[model samples]
Target: MVGRKPERKSAPPTDVRAHVLASATRLFAARGFDGTSLQAIADEVGVAKPSVLHHFPSKEALRASVLDNMLAHWSEALPRLLLAATAGEGRFDALVGELISFFAADTDRAKLLVREAMDRPDEVRLLLTAQVRPWQTAISEYIRKGQRHDEHFADVDAEAYVLHVINLVIAGLAVFDTFRVLLPDASVAESRARYVTEIIRIAKSSLFAGPALSAEPRDPSLEGAPNRRNGTTR
Candidate 1:
């Protein structure tokens, strides 16, 4: 059991690149992109800087690659989650739940994501376009599609709603580090579910109510909220 020979194992180029990206995601989250050096990323991945640079030309490039990968992962996972996310489970809550779950599940990735979204705003527009929509325009547009057939509230503005949802999701993650200090005992799952449930209640009452629910005493919990068609969160 003493001489383990380092548990020798190897992977293909794609796998290696993924490994580098995952390592960089964690390091960059802890240390900013500028703070995290190529050498440091390479060291964490147990590879040479030259090897890292061979796969990715620069540190920023590597970070961007990780972001891009995550975006792709979300694009694929969203629909499945929306479908499986039941009404009993709280569709509105589920949207919030999923976003928080995503970031909470990947602390380093979440940190890297929020930093890039806020800091490198200029570089992202086109990169995000190609990565998420490509030929589809933008994620905001895709989100708007739900409103056409009353999947969501018809009165709600699509762009506004999309931005609101995106914010609710990412904001949970953005505050994770700070919240860590406050809710140290709360698991990522708990914080996300609670926050998402709160956000959905706010959105449904204020964002979608159109003065109806406002006239009445809104339930603090979304348990009594009405359901929408198409499995969409009302």
Candidate 2:
């Protein structure tokens, strides 16, 4: 009896489910939908394949569950974030900050969305309608409010601005690897801070009716820059 070891207790169902979802999220982000399997998810979660299926009936179902859970989280949080933005001095900046922080909190989430959209458009659409589109619609309304009330937003098209902001936040995080390389001198924290500042600055300039924030003249060394998108010189 003295030499016997105490038995280890198994995690409850909720904990196991969360673990499975987390492991699946990481796997799906790193490996495309076709690249990952239920067995691999089971192995990562230290559960039997059947156990995983018990919580999620099939592979598609599991992926949906993961995305649904993430979306549910955002759905709950959005109201509070919007409220904060409304109460803040710089409402637009505050909203952008909240968004940047949200995606930055879970770097894998954006990557997962990007990968899934590219690989499994059908599945992505399901999630987009259920979760993403609602948020976009709400934010679009908020942008419209700013356009009506805020001096900076008065000239901007609410729809186009909403799309630009969403793309900037998601695409920036989705392609952060390239950002890291391009910003070799900055730490991740610095890069994120700088990026957020720049985004907010650009948004304000584009929307807000004000003089340019910087007073310095343009550098004469590069007077004529080529516009890559249209192949024109500026």
Candidate 3:
């Protein structure tokens, strides 16, 4: 009897690094990098300052990791985006829908990006030039192809158009919570639906030609395209 002891169960290992990054991202998005502190992040994660430092080493390193995480998400999605761009019909819907989802899935992402741009313009500029510019160029070339085929507007400045759409999405989502108040009659969910719908409509209407604007059905090939909203192929 006294020799018998109950076995103790071990708790699952915590992913402290991930928790720290998540807290840092949320805090940085809500309050600018200058306003957020490592101690605050530690508190949010319910860990000691040393635990945060054990993972990130410094506030600057944490900030860079947050940006890197966002960029990693985009990099993973780049292939799908490129495919949608060159896939011809329904390309606008596919491309724009994915873009919206990328940020709208977590508005924090948009806020973080906007804050980064304002807080460290030079750094953001370098990141854009080095990482985003190539994707922009590739997509621009696809737009040019569409123009050549008379599928898109000949006068559309492909580079500028892409850039503006990106800005519209990021900036729109960043402030959407505040902006939704204008639609007083609608619930938050309804307002968001309308907001996203209008963005897609405006983007499509401005970029496409005859058939796309008219009541013509979407291409059969794209009928089976993945539902970007839910991440499922139809």
Candidate 4:
């Protein structure tokens, strides 16, 4: 008994489920859903295939859970984030900052979304309409309010602008690591800061009527919100 090595304990069920979801997300992002198998996910999570199925009944269910996990975080957090700031430029900064932070906190999220969009446009469209369209409409209405108040640029298409900014943030972050190679002189942190800063700047400048709002920095607190994954607070 003295010479025996201790047995490795298995992860708790909740932790195993979370790990399986997380691993499935990364795998589905790297390889399309059709390409990734339940066995691969199990291997990634260091568990047996039955362990993965214990939580998710099938690969389709796992993929759905993974997508839902990402969207669920946004669904819960977006309203709070929007409410935290006053209207106009405050809301603008809050929205942009949170958007950037959400994806930057885990680029795999961006990759997963992008991959899904590319691989399954119709499915993603339907999912977005159901889950994301309300928020998009709310933000667009806010933009319209700013326009009516003469705070935002006249003639800006509110829906189009919101859609474009969403795409910019997701697409930009999806390829951020690879794109950083173009900025050879800067450290990864510096490059990332510059990258996000420019995005905020561009978003502000294009939307705001005057230069004052465009020059203000985004809410520092929004930038610092803890990274969330698999519907759990971190």
Best by TM-score: 3
> Which parts of model 1 have CA positions greater than 4 angstroms off?
1-15, 81-91, 127-158, 184-193, 208-234
TM-score of model 3 vs. true structure: 0.81
Tens digit per residue, CA lDDT, model 2, 121-196: 8977886687667767776776676566654546677667776887787878888866767765447776665666
User: Residue 225, candidate 1: how far off, in angstroms?
Assistant: 12
Sort by TM-score, top down from the best: 3, 4, 2, 1
Candidate whose lDDT is highest: 3
Per-candidate TM-score against the hidden true structure:
0.63, 0.74, 0.81, 0.78
When 1 and 2 are scored with TM-score, the better candidate is 2
Better of 3 and 4 by lDDT: 3
Question: What local lDDT does model 1 show for residue 14?
Answer: 50
**Residue 105 of model 4: what lDDT?**
84
Which residue pairs show backbone clashes in model 2? 152-207, 152-208
Q: Estimate, for each residue in 156-191, the C-alpha lDDT of model 1 and write its tens digit.
A: 665566556666657666676676555543585555
Across residues 16-115, which tens digit of lDDT does each residue of candidate 3 receive? 7887888888999888899998878876777667878998878899999999998899888888877876776677788888888789889989999999
Total clashing pairs for each candidate: 0, 2, 0, 0
Give model 4's TM-score versus the native structure. Answer: 0.78
C-alpha lDDT of residue 223 in model 2: 27
Total clashes, candidate 2?
2
Q: Which stretches in model 3 have alpha-carbon errors above 4 Å?
A: 1-13, 86-88, 211-234
Name the better of 1 and 2 by lDDT: 2
- Looking at model 1, how many pairs of residues clash? 0
Sort the candidates on lDDT, descending order: 3, 4, 2, 1
